[model samples]
Target: MPDRVNDTAAAYCRIWAERGVRAWEEEWWLLARDIGDRIGRLINAAPDTVTMQPNVTSAQAVILSCFDFTPPRDKVVMVDMEFPSMLYLYRRWLEGRGRVEVVTSDDGITVPLDKLLSAIDETTLLVPVSHVFFRSATILDAKAVIERAHEVGAMVVLDIFQSIGTVPVDVAALETDFAVGGCLKWLCGGPGACFMYVRPDLNRQLQPRLTGWLAHENPFAFERETLRFTTGAYRFLNGTPVIPAYYTCQPGLEIISEIGVPAIRERSVTMTSYLIAEAQKRGWSVFTPTDPAQRGGTVSLQLPEAATVCERLLAQDFLVDYRPEAGVRVSPHFYNTDNELSDLIAAIDDILADMN
Candidate 1:
């Protein structure tokens, strides 16, 4: 596993060394733009329909703020298990203006698409959902939710942060109005570099709340009163991009693209299945879905001393993320092997046995 990390880093270094810092400069911004376009294509979206943002949170805010919330259509429907940034931002936005109805989940952790869809009506302006629940690794039926929302003339926004590289997604096929994801988690891109896709039809109807020189139609023209915006997804971008962060994502995105999302999804399912089976054998409570189709790459478990168990796992050189309420979360990428999952399970068993 350490060798894999080193190899990944070396691959990135080689690419960056060949490209050089100058390759990421102005006019060369097209390099980053092209990579983003390729990613959109990979997700079955038109190349011209995607925008680059600093992070998913910023993209979510931009999409939410762009809509003009009026009377009956003022509500934004979301699940309670949404990421903290999106949850807080929506709550703050709805504080004085309108209501943000959080649809109740059967379990507090996993959101049922049917329940979420039932909450949407003619009054609903937007429906925001995570493609995969960050903690439980439960994959949502985005196609069904998007179709139902459109029936009521409501827009759907999806946060693909947890599922992008680990699961197969087609933004165009799902017909979502907006989707946001970053390179940090599954994409392996450094923090602060992310991508957003807006449907072409909605491009003209919406305006960016956070405008900057880059979003201007003629950024170099320096016109004060005549601030024209770009026709497509470029309008969503604001300010100068982080060149280093942008460069860092290029290699990772390229790798994912080369391997193909479908293949990665298969590999992830296999890894999670093995992990879950092994954990359950040791009497650990499996929190994620047992079915492959309904799950993402992450496999979560509950233990009496979850925090302590996670710390002990970390000491054994096992890397897994922990959520306070969700217990321990283990996400194995496509690069991770079944042997690694077996080792992880043995470590967990040892930790639990020690507690006993």
Candidate 2:
């Protein structure tokens, strides 16, 4: 977390006390829009293509709800390596409506591009996959995936939660139909600061069924007779804005924007390299991809009782997470140093030996 998060959130609270409910109309509400603009700039998307949401799940729901599965284009292609929340969400949505084809991982570590390409045939309507595997820390060739999806007349819905702050993403260049992510993890923003983005051209072509009053062409005109949706991306604005989340999230985005993904990626590579080397030296099985290009900011290690090991690490003030299927995920950001990773590796070495 950034040092200024407290101050920023405190400022957010002050606005609530001062402006009360009128803040939504008077001044505080537009911060929500600016937050969209800032996050849009990070992903090389136009401001109009982005809309802030409470979380990625809600954003994913909105994107899926916009699609029509009436005709032959009734298949949703995904992978076994995808984050479970939306994966299950899509799986459950396939109840008599459409087919969900899950491309299984060959080695349980990575989902090969060819597998995904094969599954996304002409009958496929949407390919909702991750830019990076959350537990495995494997980075997908998103550009290639997008190209393949478009080739078969399929749209791509990329969940960039694992890659957004750790790697450079150009949605405009990738040409994905829809993208959803949150600021909570690597972006360093707190919860409730998630966003969903659509291509400008797609926005004009598609309309969302799950929408709110703000999505109307003229929300202020209050025309109750016609419930017309807005022309651009505002069509995806579903409900009341998570305004307070806008304040706490703005600073983290600014910090990341100033540093740039390339620079953060450079530092992250160095840190993870050191981690992978030390883990190998200790005879620990590494789960993350060895190639930096195919990896994100995290390095995963396989160990017995990973949850217990993670507890020990947390007691040592070494921040990381434990996943049941993939073991421990050690994520290093711009703020983390090689020395910190070295200390963590040493701790893991001792912890593993002691446990055995």
**Candidate with the greatest lDDT versus the true structure:** 2
Q: What is the TM-score of each candidate against the true structure?
A: 0.92, 0.97
Whole-model lDDT, model 1 = 0.81
Across 1-356, the per-residue lDDT of candidate 1 in tens digits comes to: 22244555565567668877655463346644675787687778886778888878788888876866878789999988888888899989888788899987787557776778889999999998999988788888998889999999998998898888878888978889988888888877777778888898887667877777777887878777765887776787777776566656766777788888889988887888888888777787888889898898888888778999899999888998678777899988888877888888878878888899
Clash number for each model: 0, 0
Candidate 2 Cα outliers beyond 4 Å, as residue runs: 221-225
C-alpha lDDT of residue 261 in model 1: 87
The lDDT values for all models are 0.81, 0.86
Candidate 1 positional error at 273, Å: 0.9
